[model samples]
Every structure is written in C-alpha cells, then in structure tokens.
Target: MDRIKEKMNQLRLEAEEASTKVEELQAKVKNLELENLTKEQEITSLSHKNSLLEAEVEKLEETVKTLKESAAEGQAHGTQNETLNRRLQLLEEEAEQADKTLRETNEKLRQTDIKAGHFERKVSALEAERDQWETKYEDMAKKYAAVQKELEEFQMEIGNI
Candidate 1:
C-alpha cells in the first residue's frame, strides 16, 4: 500500500512536470504564431513595394522609349541639346535605384522564409512532446486506479474480519 502511495506521489509529480511542459509549449506556440503573423505582414508589405517598383520600372521604360524617339527626331531636325542628355542620365539613375530596391526586397523575403521554416520545426517538436506527455499521463492514471481498487478490496477484507 505504501509502495502504491509512493507510486501515486511519483505520478503526481510527473503529471505536474507534464502540465508545466504543456504550458510552456502553449506559450511558445502563441509567440511563434504572433511572430509568423508579423512575418506575413512584412511579406505583404514587401509585395506591395515590389508592385510599386514594377510600375515605376514600366514607367521608366516608357520614358526611355519616348526619349529615344525624341532623340532620333531631334537628330533629323538638327535640334539636339544638353537637356536631353541630362534626362537620359536621370532615367539611368532611377533604373539603378529600382534594381537596388528589388534586390533588397528579395533578401527580406528570403529571411522571412527561413524564419517560417524554423517556427514550423519548433511547432512539430512541441506537438510530439505533448503527445508523449498525454500517453504517460494516461498510463499513470490507469496504474493509480488499479492500485486504488486493490486497496479497497484489502480494506473490505479487514472489515469482514
């Protein structure tokens, strides 16, 4: 009986440890989800920026095309000037800036992907741990019930004596 009680106590302590692990896992899950949400938002924001950059690139390409046509017309008319040269220089600078922005956005997207992968792995590990704890708890509960039943039977025998 004393051994059964000791087992019960041991089971209780193990249960407490399991409970603590569950709470910790829950907290980690919540935090990870929040971080995932933040990363998603960042990805969304970067996508918007990418769209805007694409639009700007289209606009710049159209401008460059128009400038080329204008330059051809100006050469035919003997009307060339420094102003057209300056406009071409500005357009080149804008194109370079757009390319740099695209590269940076791609880098940020890659980093978000890495973080999401890490979070997924952690969640999977926690789920496995939780399952293990559930199995152990059930096993302990069954053992405890069987011990209680045996103790009751012994008490009844004593009473009849």
Candidate 2:
C-alpha cells in the first residue's frame, strides 16, 4: 500500500507541473496577440500617410508640366519678336536712302534754277516731290518706333512668363 501511495503522489506532482506549463503558454499567447494588434494599427496609420504623400507628388508633377508649356510659348514669342526687329531694321535703311535721294534731288533743282529758263516750274515740282518723300519718311519712322516699343513689351512678358 505504501508503494501505491508513492506512485499516486508522483502522478499528482506530474499533473500539477503540466497545468503550470499550460498557464505559462496561455499567457505567452495573449501577449503575442496584443503585440500583433498594436503592429496592425501602426501599419494602417503609415498606409494613410503614404497615400497623402503620393497625392502631393502628383500635384507637383502637374505644376512642372504647366511650367514647361509656358516656357515653350515664351520661346516661340521671342523668335517672332526677332523677326519683327529685322523687318524694322530694313525699313530704317530704306528711310535713310530716301532722305539721301531727296537731298541729291534738291541740289540738282538748285543747279537747274541757275541754268534753265523754266527754273521756277522745275523748282516747284521738285519741292513738292521732296515734301511727299519727307511725309512718307516721317510715317515710316513713327511706325518703326511703335514696333520697337511693342517688341520690348513682348520681351518683358516673356521674361515674366
């Protein structure tokens, strides 16, 4: 009977040890679940922040595209302005030649007055021609100035753009 009691006591001790091990395992499992829940919440917050950053990046890209388009338009305008300036230069050269021709014609008329019998008539016609040339020259000069002013304003606008 003593030996049987000793055997029963050993069985009881083994059962107690098994129960304690089970409790430790259950506590460890509960702690792991808590840690997993905390990690999941952090991941959700990080995902939301990542989406917001992506939206901002998209907006910045659109702005860059608009700026590039504006630069291209400005370059086109600059080329057109250069062409206009070249035309104005040609017009200026023509005006200068017209003035020189008028001067030469007036000198010829003065010499004709000294030698020709119909000097008065010749002088009057030559003066009229000179007056017309002067009017046309002045008009061309005014137009050139206006065009130059316009070109300057266009250049300023391109810079601003």
Candidate 3:
C-alpha cells in the first residue's frame, strides 16, 4: 500500500539521520581525547622543570650555609657574603615562580580531563539512541514485508475466483 511505503521511507530517513549524528559525536569524542593527551604531556614537562629548579635552590642554600660558616671564622670578606646573599635571594624567587607555573599547569590539565569526561558521556548517549533507531527500522521492515505478502495472497484468491 502507498501508506505503508510512505511509512517505510520515513523510518529509513530517520535511521540514516540517527546514524549520521552518532558518527559526528564519535568524531568529537576523538578530538577531545587528543586534546587531553596534549595537556597531560605539557603537565609532565612542567613538572620536570619544577624539579630541576628545586635542585638548584637546594644547592644555593648549601652554598649560603658554607659562606656563613666562613664568615663566622672571619675567613670570608663582607662583600662576598653580601653578593652570595643576593644570589640566594634571586634563586629563591625563581623557585617560587616555577612553583606557581606548575600549579597553573596542573589546573589546566584538570579542566581538560573534565571536558573529556563530558564528551564521553555524550557519545554514550548518542550510541544508545542510534541502537534504538535501528531496532525500530528493523521492526518496520518486517511489517512491510508481511503486508506485501498479504496483498499477493488476496490477489491470487481473486484471480482463482
């Protein structure tokens, strides 16, 4: 019947649309995953830099202690002690700046992880929608086939009469 054919066409179109939407969502999820990976790599690099800065700060602190001991024994000049103090101050400042940068990088990585989780949820929902559409399409196809068979059987009966 014309009505049955029309219904089949509509269901087919809806199924195709659902499939396309699922594909688009999957692509978006892949892109978000890649972005998360990039952010993780950046965090790793920043952590390494922070560790190196910490080691430098420790070395400078040791040097300052040795200089203080020399000054107590009156072996080191006053000017040299002042210069070492200034250098230690600068190194401490650099270490603080590095620590701040590391914290900011960690925050960014956390945000990226959140975004990736959101996209993953969306993909899962879309996939479920697509599966429902496929099931509906299959049910419609079977009904159409049954209707066509009924029409043929009625035609054969009329011809015999």
> For every model shown, what is its TM-score relative to the native structure?
0.47, 0.55, 0.40
lDDT tens readout by residue for model 1, 104-138? 99999999999999999999999999999999999
Q: Over 4 Å off in model 2, which ranges? A: 1-15, 106-161
Better of 1 and 3 by TM-score: 1
Q: Write the per-residue lDDT of candidate 3 for residues 1-161, one digit (tens) a residue.
A: 88988998888888888889889888988888898899899999999999999999999999999988977767555667888999999999999999999999999999999999998999999999999999998898898889889889999999989
Best by TM-score: 2
Off by over 4 Å in 3: 75-161
Error of 3 at 145 (Å): 99
Q: Candidate 1's C-alpha lDDT?
A: 0.93
- Clashing residue pairs in candidate 3 are none
Clashes of each: 0, 0, 0
Candidates 2 and 3, the one with greater TM-score:
2
Model 1 worst lDDT run, 10 consecutive residues = 76-85
True-vs-predicted CA distance for residue 59, candidate 1, Å: 0.8
In model 2, which range of ten residues has the least summed lDDT? 112-121
